[model samples]
Target: MSTWMIYGANGYTGELIARQAVRDGMAPVLAGRNEEAISKLAGELGLESSVFSLDDPATVAEKLQGMELVLHCAGPFSKTSRQMVEGCLTAGAHYLDITGEIGVFEMIHAPETSKRAADKGVVLCPGVGFDVIPTDCTAHKLKELMPNAVSLSLGFSFLAGMSPGTTKTMIEGLSGGSAERKDGKIVPFPMGSKKRTLDFGKGQQPVTAIPWGDVSTAYYTTKIPNITTWIPLSERQIRGARVMSLFAPVLGTKPVQNQLLKWVDRSVKGPDERARENALSYIVGEAKAEDGRTVTVRIKTTNAYTLTALGSLEVVRRMLGRDLPSGSFTPAGLFGSGLVESLEGSGKFEVVE
Candidate 1:
């Protein structure tokens, strides 16, 4: 009987989460800035609705009063996360979002907010979506095997294309260059600076270093001083990254970036159910202890979008089942790989000793 709020409930992924929650016979308050869309979705789902913008942090905080949990599905979370997090803290409601932005990880994990969440005694867990849930779990499992691990590496294969929200977020990161954690410090590198041929058990495929949220979260979760996250990329993508690195100065321009985004419809959604069901994802995490002991773990899961729904809801379900105090946590750090293993279409493969 845990109550939840579905923020950005009309957006592509938010819509999916809302539908799945309803399909599973769970009730969540549907909320967003668009009155017409949220109202339509609320009506369709037979749920209550809230329409408000994050323009005023105080007002946004006021609306969060009494909300037990808020599944923030809106993005670019870079722009949205801080406001909602402040609101969640104000209301003493646990905060969770589907953001994979490195900046976001740094923001929520900031000692200031972390302290606030601790004082409020409400949990602050972001990236509950496919962003880092499975991979965070994978890294956690690897760290367990190599307790003194000083370095953590994680990589994943894309299971599907981006939603409009995701596409927008990617555009925002284009000029920022890629980032990673080195010696407990956030460092930048040129796009695709590191490449590896990882075997996902299927075969060896190319993975190029990318600035994923895990670079930020893993250090917090495991205190691993050095971390790098990678993503499978095609030859064409690797080439494009090189080109982008050279042209970042031009592409970073707001006017130029805005034009690029024009081709993608912000109102347009992500993949449909058929695409989600058919898609597949793979994640591998490796950690090296100071003593040279290393452990690698692999996970195969269903569609990225689909897992976002299933994994996030399962997180909420487990939260409702317990009396978790407020504090910052990664999904796996809080619930462990048991959360990931419990999912129907996901699990860890044999550990690499």
Candidate 2:
């Protein structure tokens, strides 16, 4: 039996990870609810696979026996993570997911969930993908530079199309509005409620506050009491987001979400090989101390999805080979500030004056 599995092996991001794993010569059991797609991918990759769904925890647990870890790729994880997590706990398998959902991070990090994972000798780490890994590491590095930092801001800009999973997650998150960590508590604000101008290696561009996973995971990784996340967007996109906020409630309804998700399934195709090869992503982080001093750092990396595939595999391989203390952790918290730098195709973190 393979010690690890990649659930959702047929999804866009999942398929990327699966192909990457094969290229890297690591064989992991591919698993998902879609037997046809999963079997096809498994055959193409010449790796073992199993078909299963997350509907029943007990059944999933039984199926997960003998697996040392699961790199969950299915999303919006807000709807799929709970059952899989429960199954991991029962089966004593470490849990990892490429989820960016704020609520999902909070839920897995909750006292009860952490305690259960600890008791079961399991590790629960979420946002191990592009969702939070780079930002979390940047926050950790800045905190090290400004030990007395009281405020932290992180931002990123990526040039790539969204996968169906990513698009559906965005649709579901529409109702939650934007969020930030203020004084160590998650606070909600209206969508596009805040904006600023920042230079993410490029010239100064207008950026708006968005509810990113770092808002939830950064506080844990850096112990920064105040944290905010941003992404560059044009005035038109900002205005459109503000307009959508007015209808957030109706959009959040199940029927509306279902319809929007159907549309996503029909139209959303993730970036292709050429796009992924040509695209790049940039991230910036700043830490402010009470004495009016600040430290800023910027990072350049490969395409977002590519980074996720490589980064998640590195984490998985290490966790499997080493004996990390059993509990929940943010990516940087588990690995260290150098986590992102250790991955291939990642650039050095340049300190800015």
Candidate 3:
């Protein structure tokens, strides 16, 4: 039996991952800083629980011992990834995280940490969420269809609701402003910067180039000269997001952010029959080859969080099942275009070109 550990197992996303793990017939060790929450989740899931805090590296390393893999669901990963990565490396365990924060991605990709993980032969896969997976996987597929692709544009449309963590991450990004690659270098784009329209087959909707996890993932994975990722929203929602962007600096403060997060937590709803039935993500991509030819690919899925867990789970299964080279790697490099087919088995996605 493969022993997996789910850090932050009490979080909204963490619980979902745990539920899926049980459904897949894998016994996962639920762990987090909150002992009560972890115990509750473990009891509910009929799994074992452990206590580990990101603030305490020794405890984190101890908790990670003997685990084949760790599914990290806690975020904002900007605050937690370093310690988690260190602990995973120390324990000789594979590390995966559902982080969409570009700053965190850059931090993990730093020379020192990347080299260390590679040297230790541990896998450090990030952006395991809706942020970059759909886009990154789509980019990989597009590149296969057009190997010389020099630029890529990814757009997403979802009628589904967002998780509290997802909402808070957006608010934080809005408050801090967004950045994107332009002219071969990363440049700051104002919150909600660069607007474009997406034709989702159902209809056309406007999207803005907000700072998202994919900005860095695509760059690291594809080495494409340019990449852009966007999520579509209603005009009213876009306006509201823009307004929130104006206030982000003030609300982004620790106290204000905590207050806002509390409100979000209180109001947010977790996945249920109705919510899962209504959730869906439509991702479309346009890749421009160096020869100036453009190719397009489209992928659609339901229940973003479940699909995310499925994607990460599939990666884990593959890593364990195969004789993969040991090293820190990005999703695109590790799975390449095959991620589409891999995810298809999860019964969550469809691809149309």
Candidate 4:
């Protein structure tokens, strides 16, 4: 009976996942660098807590001892994933994180990391949350509808403000530009590579091309050669992204990124339970094959934050109960898009005309 360990158990998304686990009658040990926050949550939930900085690999490895799997919620994962992953590998535990960063997905799926995790016999999965899970699963559904699909597009519209952790993750790569999958390889694109219209059973919405985790995860999940991801935004927002290209050089600077982060920190935190309950997010995936056959799938899920918690917890439960193959994997790659189908609330997907 291996118990789950939730590192970063004090953050917004992390705390949600911890509670979700408890609601399901699972006792997971809480761990993170913030002693006060983790202690308060642990005491409230009557669960054990361990405080350790990711900077200390030895300490991280030690705390992971006897854990079946780790739900890593701490992000700006561009900085923390590697250290935590290293710790997981060394500790012989599975690694699952709620990161939507394309770079982090690429990093974890790199050949070297995949080989190491395979050799260590531990599952290495990233973006098990709202960021990629819904899109990844819809891509999988489209694959079944259009086998041999060569090109895929995913568009999503989230009607919610940024979670503090999510906002920080975005700031971390503010100037990295965008990306797309070409011939099954990740390629860098400028800030606003392209824009298009998507119909999510609702009215039409303008979606702009951006470097989303699906750029990396979908390629591995479906081996699709050409894939693009989009997020719905107003015309003004699209124009804003285009204008950003001109400022890429400046916006990418550490100082500028830091200042932007400070502004975000001062502005707002994340959604509250009511907000999470009220938010509605929609995703559309269109898959096309060389012969011109095409299929489109639309998915609806509730509360981005809540989706992250439920989706991640479900992945953890499966890992504990089943003998999943050890290697770097996206949600669809390991479990197929059906993982989304298993979502409890409004995590529903369907094909549309």
Q: Which ranges in model 1 have alpha carbons more than 4 Å from their true place?
A: 266-268
For model 3, residues 43-78, the per-residue Cα lDDT tens digits are: 988999998689888888888888888888888787
Point out where model 4 deviates above 4 Å.
none
Residue 120, candidate 1: how far off, in angstroms?
Answer: 1.0
Candidate 1 on 205-265: residue-level lDDT in tens? 8888989999999888788899999887877888788777987778789898888788667
Candidate ranking under lDDT, highest first, comes to: 2, 4, 1, 3
lDDT of 1: 0.86
Q: Which candidate leads in TM-score?
A: 2
Give the TM-score (vs. native) of candidate 4. 0.96
- Report, for every candidate in turn, its global Cα lDDT versus the true structure: 0.86, 0.93, 0.77, 0.87
After superposing candidate 2, which stretches have Cα over 4 Å from the reference?
A: none
Q: What TM-score number comes out for model 3? A: 0.91
| Residue 138 Cα positional deviation in candidate 1, in Å, after optimal superposition | 0.4
Tens-digit lDDT string for candidate 4 (1-353) = 77779998988789889998899998899998889999999999999888899988888898888887888988889889999899989998999999989878989999999999999998999999997889989888888787789999999887777888888877767677888999887888777658899997788888888888899988888888899999888889888888878788888888888888898878867888887788888889999989987888887888788889899988888899678799899988888878987887765677787
Which residue pairs of candidate 1 clash? 121-326, 122-326, 123-326
Ranking by TM-score: 2, 4, 1, 3
Error of 1 at 37 (Å): 0.5
Residue 215 displacement (Å), model 3: 0.5
**CA error at residue 154 for candidate 4, angstroms:** 0.4
RMSD in angstroms between candidate 2 and the native structure over all alpha carbons: 1.1
